[model samples]
Target chain A: MKAWSIEKPGSREVLKQIDVDKPEPQTGELLIKVKAAGINRTDTLTRQNAALKKPYPILGVEVSGVVDSNQSTDSKLNAGTRVCGLVNHGGYGEYVVMRADRAMILPDELSFKEGAAIPEVFLTAYQTIYWLGELKNEEKILIHAAGSGVGTAAIQLAKQLSQATIFATAGKPEKQEMARKLGASVTINYKEESFDERINDVTKGTGVDVILDFVGASYWPMNLASCAADARWVLIGMLGGSEVERVSLSELMRKRIALKGTLLTPRSDEYKASLSREFMQIAMPLFKEKKLQPIIHTVLPFEKLPEAHRIMENDENIGKIIIKMNQ
Target chain B: MKAWSIEKPGSREVLKQIDVDKPEPQTGELLIKVKAAGINRTDTLTRQNAALKKPYPILGVEVSGVVDSNQSTDSKLNAGTRVCGLVNHGGYGEYVVMRADRAMILPDELSFKEGAAIPEVFLTAYQTIYWLGELKNEEKILIHAAGSGVGTAAIQLAKQLSQATIFATAGKPEKQEMARKLGASVTINYKEESFDERINDVTKGTGVDVILDFVGASYWPMNLASCAADARWVLIGMLGGSEVERVSLSELMRKRIALKGTLLTPRSDEYKASLSREFMQIAMPLFKEKKLQPIIHTVLPFEKLPEAHRIMENDENIGKIIIKMNQ
Candidate 1:
């Protein structure tokens, strides 16, 4: 089996295509033949940080593949069934094994590349927006990193499922435009304007009901200022920095804000399986009906994983970047 | 009517007994002949802080009294009915007005002082534990300021309702003992030992599932370190300080903690009414059955309101301090 392994930690130069033994399906698990895998910032961070203790050297968390074998006889999944799901590790390899309950059958309407893009971003967005944020139909939401994969997915879900007013912030004008096209009621180029001031101005000082933040520390004060009373601020990533300089406890209490920090990868298999069931029930139909579409920036061949990492590092992609196996 | 008013802010010396007009019952409201009232830290803070805009000049927030009049015909409350309820303000008076919906019929098993102590502390504890924390049965919880009003209430409720292991922290040895008596599995004198170290030792590094915190900024880092994965840290007050020195977003994300800041006073009448209903349904029965008891530290004459404030300022009390209205 061919896999992208981290030869040395730190930078895209460390990523190398290497041959590895294929994984076998365990009890209640399925062995998958990788068709396509999505590239995420977490993968890049895992590859770059020497201190991060990873279970495997391979770098992928989500993959779309064909079921090669199933260990559990009663499992709905059988050999040759196309599926996409979250993997604990080793998704960068041509062959990987995943828990059967966590995998969802890929709809015929969706391609392998699209399926690869759906699991991580869509599920994360779904979990954060619906489960953590508890987004209501009439509520207003501010999504940071609007051009990123999770950001785009959140926008589409918010638009399709709820009557929420979407506010988005992106680093570049083109990215802001892309966010606007994707369903953001208002898009701000964060480089050009202060999002807090923009939110205050646009909402007439009412502020947003929920905020999906990836940019931490630098945006903490602004995020607090931009939130309405009883607002939920769901933290998914800390792209800007981690150390919050001075958080006013009084302001948080006065505003009655709920700050929830979430990470999907660290959760148990049972939890992910529940999330998979929910996503399949609610989101799969949207994909099949073309109401929701996976936004792909570029699809590179599996061997060109380093190029995909470079694209992500350069922040040149509008949405998800995919790595296609045998392309 | 006679009421205690703050002539000036910043000290208990500013509190003075003054003559005021008795408030008439408004629509869906009750005019009560005040029997007893409970003193809370919020009352003291409102008295001391010149900047905190209060609804009225009165000192107390919760009172036990006889219903003198009921304005709403549909209300279950009637003249001469004994009730304990939350007052917006003016509870430290000969007479007080409260919303009929917010008032609960007092069980004959409890005294006026106990009834006065129950409303604020028990309601706050219930809202924090069950609603905000979403505490599950058999989960471990850490309660700060375990000798205080809400802390004692929480310990009793958690023990009675949910099979939770309660870990408490207080400044004094006697206070720690009181916490243990109330239902805390372990009590740490925070002055002598580091609570985070104690928690780590006791739980064997698993940490607490929920932390009900009143001491804010100073305990921020320690609180984060003391929490288990997916912990809910419900912040009810900021007695220690408001400015958090340095909060690591990464740690919050990695632990997947939910940091919620709550204030019960500023919420709408409808919201508080709903909470009152829930407390009546679930907790009132426990009080009736003598399974849960309100812990009262002392009963001071209503005229000695300043003395009550002084005791609170010195942090000398083990449990709730009540003011007897007509003694």
Candidate 2:
């Protein structure tokens, strides 16, 4: 089996393709023949020797594949059942091993590329909006970087579960329309005008009930300001920076907002299981109903992994970039 | 009528007893002859020239008094009714005007000084524990500055409402005992013990569900480390300082914690009204049943305003320090 392993993490060059023995499924696990995998900023960070307590990691967090083998004799899944999940460590391999609970039955209507795109972003957005944000149809959410994979999914999920008002942000005018098309009630081009100004103007200074932020610590202040009284600010990523500069607690206190930070990879298996159960219950139905669609920006060959990483790093792509696993 | 007023913002010595026209009740308002006013950190901040936007620069926030006059014809309250409530712009005078909606009937068992002690602290504690903390009977909450007025109230309230585990932090051993007597299962001498060491040892590293932090930004990291997987960090004051150092959001993400900073003073009339209403509904019965009692540390003469301010600034008193009107 060929896997992309990080050898002495530094940059994209550190991602090395080497032949390795195919991993076998442990008890309560599945051996999946990887069909596709998605690239994320987390991969970049883990590759750059940042925010890793564990090292020599595989680079993919989301993957689409077929069940090649099951470890548990009593496993319910069939051998060829289509699946998508966080492949225990990550996806960048010809065959990835995952906990049986981590695997979700990929919707029949969706493609392998779309299935690969679904797991990471949707789970993050779901955890942010429902678990922490405590969102309802009566509420409104501000999705920052609405052109991104998580942002795109968040827009649709908010509309699906809550059918609530959504405010999204994009860096370019073209991206703003794309976000709007994805289900944003209001879209603001952060390049031309401040999203905060637009938020205040649109919401009549009431602010949004929830803010799903991926821009990281730099957007901390604006995210706080953009929240309504008793708002929830869920941080899924810190692309811009890590430290929030001069955090005004006075503002957070006045609004009674919750500033929550999250990392999916490091979370306990129990937590991931709970998230998967949610995906199985809520998102699966929505997918079957054709109410939700995975936003795949590009589907490149597995060998073009470096290009995929560069595209995500450049922040030029609006949705998930999938790499087909050459089995 | 005579009242303690600060013509210009400066020190405690600048506080003066001056003759002024008594405030009259407006529509839906009550003119109360203040019997006792709780001396709080808000009064201290106002004295230190904390920029206030209110039209009238009155130094008080919570007062217990006899109704001197009433303008709300339909209000259940009448002249001479004993009540306690949140004050409007002006409260540190012979007669202070307040909305009838913001007032609550004082329990017959409680004295004016005790009644005055209850409002500010109870409001802070109740909002922090129930509304923001989302505390459950089985869960534990960590209260910082546990000897302070709000901390005292939170301990009693959490004890009264449900059988929740409480970890309290106070500066002195004596304060720890007092907090323990008030129902804190464990009291850490914050001045001595590393709360991080004790908290980790106690929860077996699971941490607390909610953190009531009024110590300001200095306690930020401690609060984060002390919190559970889904922890809620509510900030009410900055006694230690507002600038928090080393906010590692990675910890927040890994734990899925909600770090929120809050202040009680700047809330809109609606929020204050809601607070008053909820307090009345949930806490009134507890007060009537004698399950709740206000902890008054000292009762100083209104003329001794400077001394009261000094006591508060030095953190000399336990619970609340109330200023008697007609001493």
Candidate 3:
């Protein structure tokens, strides 16, 4: 099996393709012949030794492929079934093991690359928006990195399943338009203008009900400013920095807003499986309904791993970067 | 008219007892003859030039008194009505003007000092538990600084409304006992042991469902560790600071927990009034039924302003501290 292994965490230079023995499916696990995988910001971070514990790290949390083998005959999924599921760190390979319950049957119309891009970001946006964000109809939503994968998924979901008004933020005009096409009510160029001022102006000083943020320190003050009374601030990634600065408790209390930080892995297996199962359930239907579509910025062959990482690190890509495993 | 005024934002030296023109009720407002005022942590923070943009720093936020004058025929209340409500500032005085809708009619059986304490902490805990925390019976709740006025209020309210398994943390044995009497299922002396470890041990590795935290930065790590799967972390204060040295994003996401920093003041007038009106409806009967009582530490003459601030800053007192305008 061909896999990208972190020989030692340092920079993108450390990620090297190496030959490895194929893994076998454990009980209740499905062996999937990896076809495509998505590259995320965290994948870049993991390669740079910025993980909970360094070394022995494989990139990619999202995967799509045909099930090569099934551990149990009683399992609902059988060999040759097209599927997608979240992985611990082993998705960036020719073959990977996925839990049977976490596995979702990929639609016939969807390609492996599209299935690959759906798991990590779609599940994250789904859980954060409905579970943590608790977004409902008529509520105002402020998505910070609206052109990114999670932001794109959230916009489409809020557009199709919920009636909430979506306000998205991006640095460039094209990316902002991408959010608008995905059903964003308004787009704010956070680079050119003050999001807090603009948000207040747009919402008539009522502020937004929920905020989905990726830029950490840079967005904290404005995140507070833009959030509505009893608003929920959901933070998944902090591209700018992690350390939050001093905030005025008076301003916070007045709005009764809550800042909730989140991530999608490092959760127990059961927790991960639940999200994976639901991604297969709720999000799969939406994918089939064409209400949501996975946007791919570039499809790089597994050999061009270094170039993909460089593109992501520079924030040059608007949507997900997919890497197809072809030998 | 007599009142306590802070000529500037600074230490207790700025808190001066001075004669000023009594506040007159304008259209759609009420003039309240303040019998008792509750001093909260916000009051102490305001006096020390700590509140957001503190130039005209008047101290109090919660008060109970008779309606001295009512200029709003739009409201149901008359001039002789007893009421309690929350305000941004300007509460520590002989007469204060409030929007007619903000006032909650006080029960005849409750003393003015207790009523004053009820408005701030009770409303704070009510929102934290019901609206933000969404605490239900049989679920686990951890109230940090469980002996403080808000903590005590949360303890009693959780017992009365939800059958939540309440765990409370206080620095002293006396305070822990007080928390237990207020209906805490278990009381932990945070000074003696690690709260995170205790929380796990008490729940057998499943942490509390909801946490009400005031000691922010110092406890952020433990707060994460103390949360159960899908836990709600609510930050109400940061006496210990606001920054955590290391934040595990993966851990936050895996558990599907929501971390939120919240403040109970500065909400829109309409929002605050709605909360007040809801709380007055739900909790008014509890006070009259003797199910809930304001835990007052001491009532001092308004001239002893410095002592009140000192006691609150030192964190030595139990429950709330009250100051009488006339004694």
After superposition on all C-alphas, the RMSD of every candidate to the true structure, in Å, is: 2.3, 4.9, 6.6
| Range of the 10 consecutive residues with the lowest summed lDDT in candidate 2 chain B | B49-58
Give all TM-scores, in the order shown. 0.95, 0.79, 0.70
Across A178-247, the per-residue lDDT of candidate 1 in tens digits comes to 8888789999888888999999999999999999999999999899999999999999988889998888
Q: What DockQ would candidate 2 receive versus the native complex?
A: 0.47
Taking the tens digit of each residue's C-alpha lDDT, what string does model 1 give over B1-327?
899987778787878888989988889899999999999888987887778564448778899989999996745688989999899988999999999999998988989988999999999999999899999999999999998989999999998899799999998888888888888999998889999999999999999999999999999988998999999999988889999888899999999999999999988999899999899999999998988999988999877888898888888888889999774
TM-score of 3: 0.70
Ranking 1 against 2 by DockQ, winner: 1
Off by over 4 Å in 1: A49-56, A73-75, B6-10, B19-21, B49-56, B73-75
Instruction: Give a tens-digit lDDT track for model 2, residues A1-327.
Output: 788877677887877887888887888888889999989877887789755554476677778899999885645666888988875565888988888887898878888888899998999888889987899776989998888888888999998889889988888787788788878899888777788888899889999999888877777767767889988888887767777666667777778788887777778898898899887887887887778888888989988898899898887798899999656
DockQ of each: 0.84, 0.47, 0.22
In angstroms and one decimal each, the interface RMSD of every candidate reads 0.5, 1.9, 4.1
Task: Highest lDDT: give the candidate number.
Answer: 1
Ranking by DockQ: 1, 2, 3
Candidate 2: chain B TM-score equals 0.95
| Residues B141-230, model 3: lDDT tens digits | 999888889999999999988878999999899899999998998899988999899888989998999999888778877888898887
Tens-digit per-residue lDDT, A49-157, candidate 3: 6554644756778899999999966456888899987887788899998888788889998999999988888888988888778898889999888888888888988
Clashing pairs in 2: A60-A91, A216-A238, A253-B261, A253-B262, A261-B253, A262-B253
